[model samples]
Target: TATGKGFTPAFVQASRGWTAGQWAEARDRLRARGLLDADGELTEDGVRLRRDVEEATDRLDHAPYEHLGQAGVERLTELAGAFTATALGNGAFPVEHFGKG
Candidate 1:
């Protein structure tokens, strides 16, 4: 909602299975929490909130493979890219997934 174009009602409905009212309520809560401004832009705290959440999510996602180390992670990404080439060229990105025998 902050950096990109805001979601349309249809997009929110289709993607999140949320009605417009539900989506608005979610935004309202964010505003009430001081994470968003009246205009729906992210406040400074909102940016930090997003960062914190992303960092935590990243940690949680990687916690399972910390023992793999940097090298292992790189190889995993490369293999994942090859495996998901048809669907997503970005590979191992949105997913920490990888593939290759």
Candidate 2:
């Protein structure tokens, strides 16, 4: 879905530590499911599906943050934001590829 959202397969593979074959297989599967087009772009349904999955993932991941409480969550976010910015600036990952929605 990252590729469908405008990331390159290479970027995804590199960032996520997936092999080229694995990425290709996943892409093919998504395409077969009508989530991706022949050109590897996301169809409308693909976009919706991706958004739904992200929402569901966020819901599932919320428990850890809740356990931290509001203030702790805020602090963690602040610290992580700084780390992320530094990583972006340092080119720890492809910013252009990862930054797209």
Question: Which one is best on lDDT?
Answer: 2
Candidate 2 Cα errors over 4 Å, as ranges: 1-6, 15-22, 95-101
Tens-digit lDDT string for candidate 2 (1-101): 44645566667788789998898899899889999998878899988988999899999998899999999999999999999999968987664665554
lDDT of 2 at 71: 100
Per-residue lDDT value at 77 in model 1: 89
Cα lDDT for residue 30, model 2?
Answer: 88
How far off is residue 80 in model 1, in Å? 2.5
Write down the TM-score for model 1.
0.62
TM-score of each: 0.62, 0.75
Give the C-alpha lDDT of model 1.
Answer: 0.69
Candidate 1 clashes between residue pairs 3 or more apart in a chain or in different chains = 80-98
Off by over 4 Å in 1: 2-12, 69-71, 83-85, 88-101
Tell me how far the alpha carbon of residue 10 in candidate 1 is from the true structure, in angstroms, after superposition.
4.4
List, residue by residue over 29-61, the lDDT tens digit for candidate 1: 989999889887789999998889888989788
Best by TM-score: 2
